[model samples]
Target: MGGDCESNVENIIEVKNLKKTYISRGHVTEALRGISFAVKKGEIFGILGVNGAGKSTTLNITIGLLTPSSGTVRIFGKNFFQHESELKNQMNIATAYADLAGNLTVYRNLKIYALMYNVPNYKKKIADLLESFGISHLADKWVGDLSAGEKTRVNLCKSLINDPELLLLDEPTASLDPSIASHVRRLILKLQKDRNMTVVFTSHNMPEVEEMCDRVALLHKGKVYMVDTPDSLVKIHTAPDLEEVFIRLAKGELEE
Candidate 1:
């Protein structure tokens, strides 16, 4: 029971000069600084950055989980700060930081999340998502008892229970083994393809970014250093590939 996103899909998420700051002990930490971007429908947009590069800050702001100290974040051309209730239904996020209830079983976690979203056919939806992520057996297991990888998959499944139009993922495969990580990528691609979902993901995995993202934004020192396809960025920045681009960019060798 999903709405016709295409009929209303006009740039799912937009960030204009976004910035966030934290003040601790009178010291200002600028998390994001004047970042601007547009996330289009039916494409996997990746935010590539190292730790503390403002990628997490940006995602947090866009998902209505954090407020920007400056600038604007517009979803479906509507500001989440002004129209949160409507925006929350249109988007869903799966980040490790947004940890689910630990005392709940995997199935219970999914069930409650689906109910919270008011997803019709909630049970069937949960079942399908659980199967897709290969986490059906853990349905009855307590979330606190599952391994990190299992919890990650369960979190992913919970995100998909509602089949959101704009899905924001933060380091989705960061803790998985290589085989499971690839499987997770394949599953995410399949979901995007099947539902024409617009996705924005952040990751440090260069090859994974190359393999999954249609376009990528490299965040450096709290700002967007570059934005382009993997191949184009590599050609312009690093002759070989994304990994090279990452290394060169991080080293400040790939200017412009």
Candidate 2:
């Protein structure tokens, strides 16, 4: 939370006064309300909130999968809407529950994604990623043949195939055992440090957020309640840990 000055920091993602609303069969829902934030280069940012807290809506807008009702989203200083197709190449997204082609082998699925991203030397890159994630032995096996955790690792490797400048992950460690989850977290931190990558991910895992994220935004009811480092938030709330801080904020026990 306490890093370089905002003026000196290099921002990778700049979202200003973002708003989104959805209308379905006579019911209108305002998903986001004037949310504004920025993510700096080589930073791991976390988004935390309860269900219907507008976390997904904000992410969807940032990734260009959905349009905001108002405000702006800029990636690398260019408007996301105007430079979407070009900007997409510089960024990639991954989810823990990613559904890879069931019939395709891990290598084949990775090849397909690499082709889509127009990755150069894709074969070597894929091999490296598989080895880095400790899933190289499963490359020739069908996706359906792998266990749940194996598939998650494969999906994570796929996301990094392009060596994207930015990575958006949604629950990247969900459903994994504690050991594997810890390993994945370390891998992400290493990648961010080595590649100077900027990452924004949503997670309900408090300890993971505390351990991995450089800063965090707590959103509620379509608005960002606070943005700061996990440790700073815990200290400000005088809570013993981030989980307790989150609980206090989520339950409206803390006045924003």
The per-model lDDT (C-alpha) reads 0.84, 0.87
Candidate 2 residue-wise lDDT, 151-179, digit = tens = 88888998898899999998889878899
Summing lDDT over every window of 10 consecutive residues in candidate 1, give the lowest-scoring window. Answer: 1-10
Tens-digit lDDT track of model 1 for 8-31: 346787777888989999999998
Give the lowest summed-lDDT range of ten residues in model 2: 1-10
Which sections of candidate 2 miss by over 4 Å? Answer: 1-9
What's the lDDT for residue 61 in model 2?
A: 85
Candidate 1 wrongly placed segments (more than 4 Å): 1-9
TM-score per candidate? 0.94, 0.93
